[model samples]
Target: MNFGPPLTTRETPAQRAQGELILGFKRLGAVTKIDTLFQQGALKARLPRPQDPTLCEAVTLNISGGVAGGDALDTMVTLAPGAQLALASQAAERIYRTPGPAARIRTRLIVQEGARLDYLPQETILFDRFALDRELDIDLQGDAEFVGVETLLFGRQAMGEIVQSGSLRDRIRLRHDGRLVFQDATRLEGGIAAQLQRRTVADGARAVAGLIIAGPEAAHKLDSLRAVLNAAPGIVAGASAFDNMIFARLLAPDGASLRQCLISALEACRERRKLPRVWQG
Candidate 1:
């Protein structure tokens, strides 16, 4: 009944875990639909019936349960002209300790003219000794709208876990009309918990997150977005706008605080529309 590797074998590198998912959405007349979907290994995408017929919502499932060292996962998404879609996950992703190499995750997103895409995946939990390398790239063509969210937790506060040591490399790149407009990266290694505890670093926060809204209307909404974040407690948050984009980052004591602030702040970016129903669960 024990499906995992035995204690003796756990120390060895886990090389068999790999997953990939590719999805495409397009608008035909008045409706947005999934035009292409491909799944390999342990990654799958599911589309739910939406209240708004013009929008496509997809929730991805990870059959492998969690990511381990030496694991490789890749995801790519595309939205054609005039299409609207929101991409989210069923639950938080967990990256476990790896005695061997680091786990790698690569993601690419493409949005054509007049299209709208919301990237709202859940949090990623980093466990002690975990080694992970992740990157995300977004390509926007013409006038497109995009809202993205990324949250990271050092460990689960409810589970009383502590990430005393680990390594992580995270990067993000954004391009508009084939020109790169935004880039960000985060790298942490060795004594992760201690490094984050520094006052100049994270101020002992256990969770960190970033939200971005890019479109013609993005910069104009900065004031309203910051207003929502100002009232949030148990967190330190700030927002900035440039080149028709609104970027905000937050550090919180736990996941609960981060989620609460996001719910309200995201509403401003979404034009008052609620987030994906899956996020509620």
Candidate 2:
């Protein structure tokens, strides 16, 4: 083996996108409002006119358009006692193809006592030759509540795009009252299209989603959530609860079907509450 000069192209600081965003909210009288917010680089947060004073709504935007290898984004959200917040992305995030290095995304969510939070970012579409690694960590203090979802798609099947080769590593961890309640991790590499078609995998599904509801009363709604998942058409979904946490997974034949099922399931998780405006339109 020779340790000569390496010859591999990589994204430079000027060519790669780097972003960091932090948002904090607290309850003031009857309304939960933004306490502190910080954004840098290609990430931004926009607050729409509040329809419900008790729940503050926010939408996140990616200024650099989409994601590519060597790109990095860091996001953190915190809620103080008695505060409520609903957060969503402006639209679906697409991961474009990269040369070698994989793009990275990290998110941290903190909910203090008596606070409630909904983190409902839209789906992520992965194109061919893409590489992505993402992680989400949620820390819930005493009696804090959290509802979140993540959706992933292999490619735009309608556009004749197929994920013939790619790599994705996704992980989520939830801790309630300082104790770990739920965790899920997925790793896929090489010939993903063929891999997803296996009988035990997705059964030819083109899209997939994961939803989690965590709170003191979360487990009680498992039955209803399961019912909603079962009734939805064009998707195969299931739900399970452990302690105060409820977890569900859905697989669909296309993005449109996934969105419909997801919207219904989200409404059920939110107890008939309306989703963020960005999701509706």
Candidate 3:
């Protein structure tokens, strides 16, 4: 019998994507305007109607919809002296399953003297086997106020998807007046679900959130924030006040509960401004 010709298989090359966005705002008279803007690849910025005349709002958009392996994004925001700006995302960022390399994200925020900046992006949803690495760096000058919030969902509980294995590395660094004021780093890999179930880890929580408020009045609001967290039911939350910064962390069994707890905590901290419209919808 004659043997058939040898068969061969061809492997497809991995697809890699990269994007960068740079935005700057300046104060002119009583209004803040975009003085510098740059966008490339899949990242873009959208200016929104400001509810406050002195505040400029910017919404970021990821045209690629979601991120997977070998994908990277970089964003930079600068606020001129005396300018005020609020930065948010158009929608929740999604991290898809990765075969190997982890998706990466880097964000840098610079606030000048007497300026104010609020970074309030929506939640980040991670799928099974997804891998992501993210870093946020904030620099503030004299008397600059900065507030930021971050939320993470391990998997879509509504869809019955649970994250059993994956990798996540997140870091946040803040410097005020050339001195480091805050630093937080978290890493989870391999059996994510099992790790989250550990009492010392997440205590079986599916969702987690963190908030940072750094300014003159941060210390004064600690007691109020603690009270709010104590009153919230079905959520594990706590807050601490440092020299000039206040930090809060929350954990819940589901995303909805986590979001409600976060909102309540923010309200207690005197963040009365309405969240971005995208967050509400």
RMSD per model, one decimal: 5.1, 4.7, 1.9
Give the alpha carbon lDDT tens digit for every residue of 111-150 in model 3.
9998888898988999999999999999999888888899
What would you estimate as the lDDT of candidate 3?
0.89
Q: Please give the ranking of all candidate structures by lDDT, highest first, separated by commas.
A: 2, 1, 3
Candidate number that wins on lDDT, 1 or 2: 2
lDDT of 1 by residue, 51-78 (tens): 5777789999888999999889999999
Give the alpha carbon lDDT tens digit for every residue of 1-281 in model 2.
77989899975654889999999999999998899999999999999987777789999999999999999999999999999999999999999998769999999999999999999999999999899999999999999989999999889888988988899999999987778878899998988999899978899998999999999999988998988889988889888888788899899999988999889888888988789998898
- Candidate 2 lDDT (Cα, 0 to 1): 0.92
Residue 197 deviation, candidate 3, in Å?
A: 0.9
The total number of steric clashes, by the backbone 3 Å criterion, in model 1 comes to 0
Per-candidate Cα lDDT values, in order, are 0.91, 0.92, 0.89
Q: Hey, what RMSD does candidate 3 come out at?
A: 1.9
TM-score for candidate 1:
0.94
Residue 99 CA displacement from its true place in model 1, Å: 0.9
The most accurate candidate by lDDT is 2
Clashes found in each candidate (C-alpha, N, C closer than 3 A): 0, 0, 0
